[model samples]
Target: MKGTVLVTGASGFVGRFLCMRLISESWNVRGTLLESESPSCLADKVEPVTVEPLGRNTPWTHALTGVDTIIHLAARVHIMDDHAADPMTEFRTVNVDGTAQLA
Candidate 1:
């Protein structure tokens, strides 16, 4: 909570609140969003980074720099018109694989 923290799904509701609160408490917050830059951030306290959720082979070296903690909030949300043949597999690809990519 006090050290450098990396947050995933930072464009979402929970991620937004968490980053704001952490900044208020004097925590160095680094958040990851799908877009190049999303939801803006505190110039001094929080750094917003752009990253894909299901990065099959993306390297997280630069993103994980100086990060002491990681809060994984990223997920593949189910939409009205489903497309993936296997929802669980798709979920694992993003949620599971993504987490590994970060770690």
Candidate 2:
């Protein structure tokens, strides 16, 4: 085992590839997915954990157990035509506060 690594957004394009690479490198990969998302999309050997609405208050204790490293790929991606009343705050909530909480 290279080490235990927790990868957020493991079903996303970049995340899928990263998980594959880590798997090939012999790391124990734990992936975070949405409650409705399926773990079948991830690479073999990945341990999937369900988490939703990434934010400061998002519960992470269950996912953080024995994790040697965390590669945070979960974020509120920028939309070209974002319709949110406060887009910046939304982004900050997930990207900033959520990441901070995870750390």
Candidate 3:
């Protein structure tokens, strides 16, 4: 094991695939999901961790502990509808703010 690799949004499509590939390579994997989501599906494949948004009072210190590398795949997807809420804000919140905190 090359230390623990932290993967945010490990329950998602791309995240799942990345995790599986890492597992096959014999790397120690740690996955982070929102507290509301279930990570049991990856139980045998990798270690699952529940993390909340940065401003939601979620403790990130524990999640980052011993993490040699971090692959952040979590983000708020863009809506096709023009009437949807501002995409810039959503992108900033997840892509910018979230990524900054993790880094």
List lDDT for all candidates, in order. Answer: 0.74, 0.91, 0.78
Off by over 4 Å in 3: 41-43, 54-58, 78-87
| Residues 1-103 of candidate 3: C-alpha lDDT, one tens digit per residue | 7667988878877888999989888889999877777778553578888788743234689888888999888877745674637768766777777777776
RMSD (Cα, Å) of model 1: 3.0
TM-score of each: 0.77, 0.89, 0.81
Ranking by lDDT: 2, 3, 1
Could you say which candidate leads in lDDT? 2
Clashing pairs in 3: none
| Candidate 2 residue-wise lDDT, 1-103, digit = tens | 9899999988888999999999999999999998888889887889999886788899999998999999999888858899989999999999999989898
Which prediction has more favorable TM-score, 1 or 2?
Answer: 2
As for TM-score, the candidate ahead, 1 or 3, is 3
lDDT at residue 63 of model 1 (Cα atoms): 73
